[model samples]
Structure formats: structure tokens, C-alpha cells
Target chain A: MFAAAALALLVALILLVVRALKGPTVFDRLVAANSIGTEAILLLAVVGFLTGRPEFLDIGITYALLNLIGTLAVLKYFRFGDLSQSGGEEPEN
Target chain B: MEAVINMVLLTLLVVVTLGVVRLRNLFAVVILGSIYSFLMASVFIVLDAVDVAMTEASVGAGISTVLMLTVLSMTRVEEAKPAHSPLLPLFVASATAAILIYGTWDLPGFGLAQTPVNTHVGAAYLERSIADTGVPNVVTSVLASYRGFDTLGETAVVFTAGIGVLLLLRRGRSRARLKKRQEERT
Candidate 1:
């Protein structure tokens, strides 16, 4: 059953890769990349279970944190031209 | 099952890499590169190298993608066309890859206990690590105690790189401030 789930995740990954490569816009690619990260995290966890080494879930947790950070960083960079800049929405006192 | 997963991940890696190479848009290329790294980390996990997989996920997929995007923000997003044909480089790359694959043909099969790596020093390390360092994870004990100096060197290298980046960014900030002060004086 874990094997079947892992295979399904791999199939999802392939589909995500297709979206990423065929993207005509940067946002499309970005979304695909984010989804790919999600699929990868799932694959890692499922593979860990399949291998009977559930300890690999730690790596999955680490990956989840990194994926969140990376995706946010990219989105922030897209919105703000510079990473150092405070969000322009707030009026300075 | 492991073999099937490894093959799928490796194939995905190749596809993403090809996309990275063929795409001219830097942003899309960076995204594909991150995908490539994700697949690579999965491959490492399937191969039972959890620590390496963790490092790949954090460094390859996370930090490098951000770093590359920052670099792209500083420059034109479209890659410039090369002046020369890519044929020679392609031929060279293929030849190198072929040679590497040929070399691997003679290596022992994967996960064999009798392989030199498993039989030699690795066996000794595995046998002694828990007793020597009281670390449950053999990788942790090996990295922290038995091969402590190597790990220290790796840490020192990372520290040096971080300091170098900090110095460069500081210089750039100070220079900008100097320019602003000069403008104010005018």
C-alpha cells in the first residue's frame, strides 16, 4: 500500500514537472515549484514508512520547514523588489 | 520497491535538469532547478542516505533556490544567447558522462554487505561507534567523534563563507550610505 502511494506521489511529481516546464508565466512556474516541494515531502514520508525506518520523517519535517521558508522568500521577493525593504503597506509614523 | 522509487526519482531529476537547460527564462530555470533538487533529495532518501537527503533538501532546494532568485533579481531575467554553437560542449559533456558510467560498471552492486566499503572501515565504525561515543546514530557518532576534525573543518569553511558574505554586504551598505550623505550635502 505504501508502495502504491509512493508511486502515486511520483506520478504527481511528474505532472507538476510538466506544469513547471510548460509555464508561460513565472507565477505558473512558482506554483508548480511549490507543489513539487509538497509532493517531495510526501514522497519522503511515504518512502520512510515503506522502508520501515520511520525516523526519516525527521527529514520530512525539516523539508517542510525549508519549503515554507523558500516559497515565502520567493513570494516576498516577487512582491517587494528588495528583501530588506519593509512591506510598503504600513505608513511610517 | 526501493529500486522502482529510485528509478522514478532519477528519471524525474533528468527531466527537470533538461528543462533547466532548455529554458531561457531565469526565473523558470530557477524553479526547475529547485524541483531538480527536490527529486535528488528523494533519490538520496530512497538510497537510505537520510542525512545526505536532509542536507540536499535544506541546502539544494531551500537556500540555493533563494540565493539564485536573489541573483536573478539583480540582473536581466532572460538569458543571453551564446555566440558559439553548443555542439562542442555537448560532445564533451556526453563523453565525460559516458566515461563515468563505464567506470561505474565495475563497481560492486548496491547494499551488498560484502562490498569493500561495508566490509572494511565502515564495518569497524559501525561496530565501535555506539561503544566509543555513546551516540545512538552511527552517522552522528562518526561525524562528531570519530571524524570530528573533518566535521570541524566543514564547519569552519561554512563560517568563513558566511563571514565573507557579511563583509561584502556591509561594504555595499556603507557605500550606499556614503552616496546618500553626499547627495544630502548637495
Candidate 2:
């Protein structure tokens, strides 16, 4: 039963990949990538349970951190010409 | 009993995924994706993995959607429905799925007693982790104490990425401050 649930998530991951590949714009790509990252988090947990290794929770947490930072970096790049400039330092009002 | 729980979770996951694919509005897609994550988190909770569920709810549903929206603000929402046929993806995805299912043929059937993981350090850790680590969550114990070094490496990787992005995105610093000020005002 959990096996079936994991399969469903794997399918969702595939859809995220599709949305990412076929995105009409960078924003679409961003959303798709976010979904992919999310699905990966769940997959890590589910797979860990299948293997009965709690260590995989660590992997899930790490992936969560990576996913958040990566999304921010990408967003920063899109908003500013480069990553450092947009969310880096503050401008004087 | 467990079958019922897993089935419900799987159904929710699939439905929300389709929502992610079929939604015309970008905002709606983001919300749906979060729902998808929430469902996945619930599955983890049912498996008795509380730590993973907490992180998924926080990072997947909370931070992810917020960051996506920030990125969205920097660009235009795609108004048109993407219409690519899923021929290649369907083939590839189904093939991968089939392989996964086949691999599970050798796996223990839904929490049997004789699984190897239940006999190794895995079991020892689960049984004794509370006594060894001050933290009640075994997941945290394993990550912080038993595998602390590896976790550090992962943290460094995250820090490096953050610094890299910070380096690349700072466009003269002056305008960035301006944007923040504008946001605050708005």
C-alpha cells in the first residue's frame, strides 16, 4: 500500500519534470522546479521507510535546505541581473 | 489498516499532482503543489517519521511556495496553458515506475518482522537512541550525533550555495537596498 503511494509520488515527480521542460517562461520553470524539489523531499522519506533507515530523514532535511537555497538563488538571479546584486546588500532610500 | 492509510495518501498525492499539471493559473498551481506536499508529509507521519513530516511541512509547503512567489514577482505569470503531449515522458516515466515496482518485489511486505534493517544497527539505534542522545527524536539523533560529520558537509554545501547566489545576485548593492525600501513602502 505504501508502495503504491510512493509510486503515485514518483508519477508526480515526472509531471513536475514535464512542467519544467515545457515551461513557457522562467516563472513557469521556477514553479515546476519548486515542485520537483518538493517531490524529492517526500520521495526521500518514503524510500527511507521502505528501506527502514531513519538516516534518510537527514537526507530529506538536507534536500529541503538545498531546495530552499536553490530557489532563492534562482529567484535572485532573475530579479537582479546577477544573484549578488538583488538580495545581497541594501540600497539607501 | 495500514493499507487504507497508504491508499488514501496515494490518492491525494495523485489528485494534487494532476492539479499541478492541469491548473491554468500559476498561483493555483503553486497552492496545489503545496497541497501535494502536505499529503506527502502526512504519509510520512503515518509511517512514524515525525522529523521528515515537520521538515516537509515547513520547507516544502511554506518556504518553497513563498520563494516561488518571490520569483513570480520578478517575472510575468504564464497565462497560456502548456499543451505538449506527454508521449516521451509517459514512456520514460512508466518505464521507470515499472522498474521501481519490480525492485520492490524483493522487499519485505508492508512491515514484516524479518526485514534485515530491523536486525542491524538500525534496530539498535532505534531502541537505544533515546538513551544515547538527549533529543527524543531518533531522526535528529542519527543526523546530529551518529552522522554529524556528514551533516556538516551537507550544511557546508548549503552555505556555499547561498554564498554563491549572494555573490552573483548583488547588483551594485545600491539598487538592492532601493528595492527593499520599495517593498517595505508597498
Candidate 3:
């Protein structure tokens, strides 16, 4: 049952990767990439279980954090024309 | 039963990959991508790595989708056409896929008790982890204590990424000062 599920996810990941490659827009690719990272975390955990090595769970947690930060940073950079310009607080100008 | 399950999983992986590539709408694509992550997490569960499954579900299917969607709200989800052709990516991706598929052959058969990985330092850690670290989860013990230094390094790296993002996203002092001066003049 689990194997089948994992297969489904692997397929999704491959598709996402292609989308990332052929993204019609940068955001489309970013979305795809973000999804892929998410899938990979799951994949890591699943594989760890199948292999009977539980350490992968930690890696998954770390990966999740990194993925979120990376996605947010990318989005922030693309917005406001300048990443240097922070949101939420207005510049005196 | 296992064979049937593996076959099904493998088929889904392929189909989703194709769908992701073929889809035109960026929103739909993101949704599909999320589906893929969710499925992958399921696969991990089947593999018997419960801890891993938890992380995947939490991180992959949960946080990632939210982060991406948030990013989507800020930018154009769909991409415009590039001036150049895209044949190169297709060629590269397929070639890389072929190589990775071939590499899987060398991996130990799943769940083999005597596999080299289980025999070596892994066994030592597994055996001693509970007694030494007083942690029931060997994974946690190994990550936090046996190889604590490596974890520390990894944390530092993440911190650096956070710092880098903060610095990059932060307004320069000059810009802030200029704005302040402008306000005074006004």
C-alpha cells in the first residue's frame, strides 16, 4: 500500500521537475520546485523507513525548513523590485 | 502483493511527471505538484520509515505548499516564452534520468538485515544510542549526539541562509537614511 503511494509521489516529482524546467514563468517553476522539494522530504522519510534507517526523518525536518526559507526568500527577492526593500514597514521616502 | 504495489507506485510517478510537464496553467501545475509531494510521502510510509513519513507529511506536503502559494501570490505564476528554444532541457533531463535509473541497481535490496549500511557504524550507533544518549529514537541520538558536530554545522549553514536572506531583503542604511532626510525636508 505504502509502496504504491510512494510511486505516485515519485511520478509527481518527476512531473514537477519537468515543469520546473519548462516553466512558462519563473513563478510557475518556483511553484514546481517548491513542490519537488516537498516531495523529496517525503521521499527521504519514506526511503528511510523502507531501508529501516530512521535517521532520514531528521533530514526531512531540516529540508522542510530550508525549502520554506528558500521559497520565501525567492519570492521576496522577486517582489518590491528590490530585495533590499523590506515589506510591512515603510521607508521614510 | 509487494510487487503489485511497487508497480502501481512506479506508474503513478511516471504519469504525474508527464502531467506536470504537459499542464499549461501555473496554478494547476502547483496543485499537481503538491499532489505529487503528498503521494511521495505516502510511499515513504509504505517503506516503513515512520519517522520519515511524519517529516515528509509535515514539511513536504504541509509547509512547502503554503510557502509556494504565498510566493505565487506575490509574482506572475505563469512564465513567458524564452527567445531561445527548449530542446536542450528535454535532452538533458532524459539523459540524467537514464543515468539515475541505472545507478539504483547498486543499492542493497530493501530490508536486507545484513546490508553493509546496517552492519557498520550504523549498527554501533543503533546498539549504543539508547544506552549512551538515553534517547529511544536512535535517529535522534545519532543526529544530536554521535554526529552532533555535523548537525551543528548544518544549523550554522541554515542560519547563514537566514542571515543572507535577511541581509539581501533588508533595506540598505543609506536608503533608510535618504528616506529619513527626505521626510525631514518634506
Candidate 4:
């Protein structure tokens, strides 16, 4: 049922946290953080169903959008020294 | 079953916090912080605080991570080694935590109808929210209508944060442009 699925998701979240914590490279941590966001969205939707409140799904959708924007922004900032930098040419690192 | 879930989530949160504390790399710490926020959102949902959970998910997991990473990009990715010993701070933190946990010992059991919060204002809200505001979601009615001023203040805080970030990041661009213009003129 929902409880079982939630438990599984919790396990996955813990594993992701472990990966994030033990990452030897920055990209590894970033990937772990992205996966954690994905798991949170799923957790929110599943919890909404378990609680019989479908309205919570609206918040879940918002979280998903924010997650996407945040990951892309961080990646872009890392690639370019400035956030407002144009994507036309690569900056010498 | 719910209690079990809550306990499990809370334990994971503790583990994540410990990881954040032990990790010296700023990038790992930021990632762990995001994971911690995700765990907290789930805990909030299990407590039936859906609105709080939503805010935590968006602000804590989403915005805070991006902001922290942005800071990392501007600074050194690796944390500096501390010159001082950590024992004194550890002792102080442990004492504070112990006292705080002890302070919670006298709180009423969760969800008890006879508790002051449940019997007093909560009862009134549950009874009158539908009739007064015609909103089926009592939380929405309470936040948007009944507590209009408080919601407005929260919105203002978010607006201020957005403006602050824009000012901080955009200033560099303007300065660079000014330097280029001055050089060209010379």
C-alpha cells in the first residue's frame, strides 16, 4: 500500500543522501541532489494520496518546477562565472 | 503505522544532519542540506501540515540549494580547515540541545482534543471557517482571508529576498560594463 511505497521511497532518499555526503566530486553531489528532488516530488504525491487530499498535488507540481529551475540555474552558474552571461561563447575557465 | 513512519523519517533527518556537520566540502554540505530539507518536507506532510510542507519543499529544497550553490560558485568550493578545536562548541551545542529536548517533555500529546490549542482557537476555526469564508480548505481560508496581514508580510519577505539577490548579482555586471565603457573612451 501507500505506507510500503513511502517506506521504499524513504530508503531511496537515505541512499541518495549517503551518495551526496560521500561524493568525491562536485558533479556526483549535484546528481545526488537532483535525484533527491525527484524523490521528494514522488513522496509528496504519494503522501497526498495516502492522506486522501489530492490538493497537495498542486504543491508537488510547484516543487517539481522549482527543482528543475534550481538545478539548471546552478549548472549554468557553474559553467559560466556569471548567471546573466550569454550562452553564445564559452568562457575560459 | 503513522508513528512508525514519522520515527523513521526523523531518524533519517538526524543522520543527514550529522552528515552535514561532518562533511568539510562545501559542495557536499550543500547537497546534504538539500537532502535534509527533502526529509523535513516529508516529515511535515506526515504531521498533516501540508501548507508548511509545501513551503519547506520549495524554499528549503529548491531555492536554498540554488542560493547555496551560487555562493559556492563565487567562493572556494572546499571549506577551510578550522584552526581552533571544536570541543567547546560541541559541548555548548549538546547542552543547548539537551535543555531544549527537556523543555518539550511537558507538552500535551499530539492530536489530543482536550489540548489547549485544539479546544480553544482551533475549535472556533474548524467550526466557522466554512461559514465565514466559504472555503472548503480551512488552511487556505485561515491563511488568505483570516490572516491576511500575516500572509502579506510573508509575501513581502519573499519579494525582498528576490530583490536582494538581484542587487547582489547584477551589481557586478553593471560594474564590468562601466569598466569596459571607460576603457573604450580612453
* Each candidate's fnat: 0.78, 0.06, 0.06, 0.69
Q: Of 3 and 4, which scores higher on lDDT?
A: 4
lDDT of 2 at B154: 92
lDDT of 3 by residue, B1-186 (tens): 335445555666676767777765655565556556655655655565555655665555555655565556557767566677789988998999999999999888987999987787887887788789999878778778988999999889978976874564344645666887898999
Ranking by TM-score: 4, 1, 2, 3
In the range B99-158, model 2's lDDT, one tens digit per residue, is: 999998988877776778777688889888988887776778899998999999998997
TM-scores for all predictions: 0.88, 0.56, 0.54, 0.89
Candidate 4 structure quality by residue, lDDT tens digits, B1-186: 667778878888888888888887776787788778878888898787888888897888778887887777779977889999999999999999999999999999978788888877888998999999999889999999999899999999989999998897788767866876898999
Fnat for model 2 comes to: 0.06
Best by TM-score: 4
Question: Pairing residues by index, what is the TM-score of model 2?
Answer: 0.56
The list of candidate 1 runs beyond 4 A from truth reads A82-93, B177-186
Per-residue accuracy of model 1 over B28-142 as CA lDDT, tens digit each? 8878888888889888878888889888988898879878876876798899999999999999999999999999999999788888788779988888888899998899899
Q: Evaluate residue B180 in candidate 4 and report its C-alpha lDDT on the 0 to 100 scale.
A: 68
Candidate 2 per-residue C-alpha lDDT over A1-93 given as tens digits, one digit per residue, 9 for 90 to 100 = 657767787668656656654567667767776776677667666766765755657656766775676667556544653433434444332
Residue A91 of model 3, lDDT score: 38
Cα lDDT listed for each candidate: 0.82, 0.67, 0.65, 0.82
lDDT-based ranking, best first?
1, 4, 2, 3
Give each candidate's interface RMSD in Å.
1.8, 9.7, 8.5, 2.0
| Model 3 chain B weakest 10-residue run by lDDT | B1-10
Place model 4 in a CAPRI quality band.
medium
Q: Chain B TM-score, candidate 1? A: 0.88
Two-chain DockQ for each candidate model: 0.64, 0.08, 0.12, 0.65
